[model samples]
Target: MTTLTKNKVNDLIMSQIPSFGSFQTLREEGLAFLKEKGLPAMKEEEYKFTAISKKLEQSISDFSPAGKVVLNAETVKSHLFEGFDGDIIVFNNGHFDSELSSFQDQSYELNQLSESSPENLGKIAKIEKDPFVALNTAAFEDGIYIKVGRNKQVEKPIYLLFFNQANQGQIITPRILIEAEDNAEVTFLESSISLDEEAYFCNMVTEVKVAQNAHVHYNRLQHENKKAVTVNNFETDIHRDATFTSVVVSLEGDMLRNNLTLNLLDSGCEGNMYGLYLLDGKTHVDNHTNVDHTKPHAESNELYKGILADSSRAVFNGKIFVRQDAQKTNAFQQNNNILLSENATINTKPQLEIWADDVKCSHGCTTGQLDEEALFYLQARGIGKIQAKGLLLYAFAGEVLEHIANESFRKHIDALVQTRLGSSF
Candidate 1:
């Protein structure tokens, strides 16, 4: 085992002194875990493309509690949930804002991490291993803990909003944990927005646990400030016969990286993942996803598409793993990209590792520019070049957006994609 000096671990622990009072034990445990395992090196296959060491080298500071921000109801409605109905839970810089949050009867419980019970803490501690996860477990002051009871269906979705209004050169970490009990159905929309031009870092971790026979839909909409850096990690556990769907839409940020993992623990489980990224200027976005089939008869499907314009770049790495006992497993994955400029670049890799003999798995990825033949055909039919390109791009992205079961939400995302494509498109 790799070892870290005691003083080094203590010094790292000291950096979190401001937000380190309540969770001191958790912090020490995390420090010890890091000392034993050390940080993931560049040689680690999973972290090869993502150079997290540079990020960890930066000074670590405590994220002060941002009590609340004055936001007009109209502005909130306009920015989030333009065409959907849901219970809204707002967080300003990692702290829950009860004043701006609204909930229905007892369909769900919304509480802060600081107010969570010992039982919940035990659950969170069970999965805290990665350096970032350990860091979040060590220094997270306040966040949201949502639970949907058994046999209950949340008719309205739950919206978790994370807004960053930090000073320049500041960094914020928003940590959240959600649990859906057996036979429960729920939809969660998590958004990250910013209102300043600061170079802040929003390092967030969200852990979700889905009980047997439960259905859960989790969507992440990241539209942080153009000058900010955001790294989000989503980890999910799906039990017997459960279904979990995750969709991520990223539009703005300087450097953004998302790590998503779905673990199928029991038979007859289903997992779906979809992502859409639109980047321009000098923005860089990376999406790394993993799906693990641990039990027999599990199924998973994943599709990710990107539109890169200007001089932006995007990277996609998706992996599917089937254990030896996971017989009769079925998994499919595909990634496609469209480069709008000569300088734009896209790197995509779809991987499948199957140890079971009876599994059916297939994976493929394609990256290419817009079809000139199709563009010429449309232009020849009296369509303008800009309009023809826009139409083609819309059709290229339509397949993935069609997976959204909600009509209104689908239309909303469609419009957003069109608007982001700009007038020239």
Candidate 2:
């Protein structure tokens, strides 16, 4: 286990100066909590495979606090979605960029996080458990707030683009809050891009609340510089008869870690999660998801897949909890991984804890290489070796890709996947 001295952690916390609203209480509390309980060490079972202390130490040691970054509109123009006609909210170096943001109508309200009330801001998710989230709550300077009014069903999707232009040895923490009221429906898309080839750290946290009968579809795309380290945490609360769906895709980054938590707070709530990761080089990706069933008749389903090559490493840990009162709950979880290189490593675990005797729950995990017989079958039909391998991997990944509802975005992701698999030929 790696433990940092109080002086060192205090120095790290004092490195950044917040320009947003007064958050000294959160900062002080977070610093105290961090001092008492340092970063997750190797001995910690929850973070055994993807320990963060060493990497975090290095990143923090190299941290250089930066002033507000001035970005030209044309410089980030290429990062926008090609065919999506929905609203676009852009964040430049963790700060909301009003000039780059656009919305379709007044069906929803968009504001800066600093303008929101503290009760409304931090009530959705608890951050005391994770030091990363506590640090984010302490240090976040600016963020976005989105709220869909009651009975508002937005036809177009809402896009959130987080563009990072950090210099070497800098860290950016971006925060987001979303609330979907009763009977409201909306689709949200989140994508991150590292503009330069600077080695930096990006920490992000998003909190969502879905009211009764509300529906929300959320997709997060991570395509950053290979030298950058990104950590994202998502916390959501689903109310009665509400539904929440999340899809996460990680394509490029030095190290990526995601912590997703869903709370089925009321009866008839539904939660669904899906993920796809394609990693190569020395990249590392970790995904940890937790779903809590607190009421009866709630349902949750989770599926995650990974393809690792070269010396890449990946980890997936999913947990489902059914309380005693959560009778009639149904939950399912699965994880699948494909390791293309002998040096690549994957650790996956699907866990289910059911206290209610009247509930149905199941979990499974699998890790294996691509089927050689399938490759041989394709090669026998005059296909080249590389082409056959690409075909098989493509088919394996297509099962998840085909579930994407956005045709244009799905095609874009498909092309990227093909390029990664060398199937574009």
Candidate 3:
């Protein structure tokens, strides 16, 4: 193990301190926290699979920071929105790009969090226990803050486009905050892309708050370059009778890690999460999710599927916690993976901690290769081996893709999947 010098670590932490000027207490507290805890080591259970401490030690002194990035209207038209028409928020190198975004609707307010009053920072500071959240709170330069008024239903989806165009070895931190008022309904689509071959580090945090009876649909697509590394944290708060649905699709990147946490603060809430990953080469993808049922009569369901080929590795760790008072809670979780090569690997763990006797909770996980009988049957029908394998893989992924309510978006993702599979299909 490489040793990280104290000065190097302090330098990285110091670079992140300027963004938290408004919250003086949090700023000081976070700095002290980092000084105490420092970078997460391999001993940390949450980071066991993807050992980042070594990477930090090797590159700490040579770390690069994102520089200015420019985008034009035509570029935005072609890359940001493309086919969808809605309120769009674009960020380049983690800074708001107002010139490339569109927000003409009246029912919604899209603004930069940095331009808002210092009071609003406290809203995100409330969840500072998470280390990544604290890091984002300290380092975030600019982000989109979208709020839908009460009793209003957005007719179009709110799109967020994040682009990374920094020099090689640049590191960027992007933050997002979304709030849906009571009885309001909205959809959010976030896409992350890269323009060049840079070894970048993206530490992003998204905080979502859903008011009573509100509905929110959130989807995230990650297609960054294989030379980049990303660590994303999603924290959500659901009120009484609210509904939250989240879909995550990851297709490219050298190493990617996502942490999703849902807090059921009130009763009668519904939460659903789905994820699909197609990994090849030496890629590493890890998804860690936690669903907390703090109140009664809440429902939570999760399904994650992975297709691993080559020597890639995937990890899924899901935990469902039912508090003692959370009686009558209904929770289900399933993780399935298909290994296409002998060396391809998957580590799946589903845990349920139920303190309430009246709750109904179950969890299961499965990892295996393709069935020989099914392959033989397809081959016997005159289908080529590669085409048959692609078909089988598509069918496995279709289970989650079928849940996409948007027809065009579903078709777009389907096309992306086919393209990734090469000429096999």
Candidate 4:
């Protein structure tokens, strides 16, 4: 492994100067924090299993911001959802592509990051500890601001399509802020993709605020080119009695690190997070998620599954923190991985830090191969070996996939999973 120092990361951050308008101070703080901690080193507690700093250094050593790539509707026609009817917002190369977006709804508003109010822009996304958030806040080229008005329910899911269509190596930072007003309800589906097998870095941050009693269901699908590297952070603040759910599906990438956090700021909130990573080749995926229970009577549930093949690797670090005042809190976490190849690697840790007496919390992790007995039984019952293995793996991953509320989207994911495993049945 190459030695990637903190100074080199900080130098890269400083080289790409940001032009933050009203949020300059926020960016400055992120720069300072990045300089202090640098990128996550392998020796760090949270990053011990994955050498993220090295991956980032290699991907972004000659990083430069790419110019606008001309994309028309026909270019992305094959990538769009076939039968889904929704408002689609497109971001090309980390910048909002208004010409490509098909959003004309009056109930919701989408604007550039610089157009948002200074007082509200940096309130929900605090960058005190995470340098990545600070870096995104300071250097993001362009992003989307989505606001669902009070008491309104969006009839259809709003789709955020982020496309990295580049032919060279560069770094792209995309920032997003979403706010759902009190009593509002919305569904969001976000997908990140790279059209070509080009080496690039996509650093993205999405901050969401769910107001009192608001309900949100967010689906994140990452299927970037295998030659690309992606670092994504998702932070959400749930208000009183609000419900927030996130389902992340990782299909392809060379190296990916996802940091997902949910903060229960008010009482009686519910947070649910689920993820599935199907990896092969030399792909590496790291998912670090945290749920903070700061209020009483909040409940949270988490489940993540991984299917690794060849020499791929997967890392999962899930933490649940119930503060002193978070009484009557209920939290549960489970991570399960199935390795199809002997060389596949998985590191999973489930952590619980609870100071509340009345809380019921539990965490567990399991990593192993498929059940040989079951495979043998299926094979003896006239099923082909490969088919039996595929069936077992499908059933194993279906637990997390079943949580998807959208039937169509769930089927789409199921198809992708089946294709990945070469399962014809």
lDDT of each: 0.76, 0.82, 0.79, 0.84
Candidate 1 runs further than 4 Å off? 1-13, 18-22, 33-44, 51-75, 118-129
Whose lDDT is greatest here?
A: 4
TM-score of 3: 0.94
Question: Which ten-residue region of model 2 has the weakest summed lDDT?
Answer: 59-68
Compute the lDDT of residue 299 as modeled in candidate 4: 98
Name model 2 segments beyond 4 Å from true: 15-22, 62-66, 423-425
Kindly give the number of clashing pairs for every candidate: 0, 0, 0, 0
* Alpha carbon deviation, residue 344, candidate 3 (Å): 1.6
List the candidates' TM-scores in order.
0.89, 0.95, 0.94, 0.95
lDDT accuracy of residue 191 in candidate 4: 84
What C-alpha lDDT, on a 0 to 100 scale, does residue 14 get in candidate 3? Answer: 77
Give a tens-digit lDDT track for model 4, residues 1-425.
12464666567667775765766677777878777766667777878888766776666664466556777898756677666778888888888888888876677778887787535565676776466677677677667789998998887888888889655557788888999999999998888878777888888888899999999999988988888888888889999999999999998989999999999998999999999999998999999999999999999999999999999999999999999999999999999998889999999989999999998999999999899999999999999999988989989989998987666777878889888877422
lDDT of 1 at 390: 86
Clashing pairs in 2: none
Which structure is stronger by lDDT: 2 or 4?
4
Residue 91, candidate 4: alpha-carbon lDDT? 83
The lowest-lDDT stretch of 10 consecutive residues in candidate 3 is: 1-10
- Could you give candidate 2's per-residue lDDT for residues 1-425 as a string of tens digits? 24743456556666764644556666667666766776677688878898666676665554344445777777666766568778888888888889877786789998886776435565655667577777677667777788999999888888888888777667788889999999999998888887788777887888999999999999878889888788888999999999999988888898888999999999999999999999998889999999999999999999898899999999999999999999999999999988898999999889998889998898998899989998898899999999898988888788777756566677778888899999322
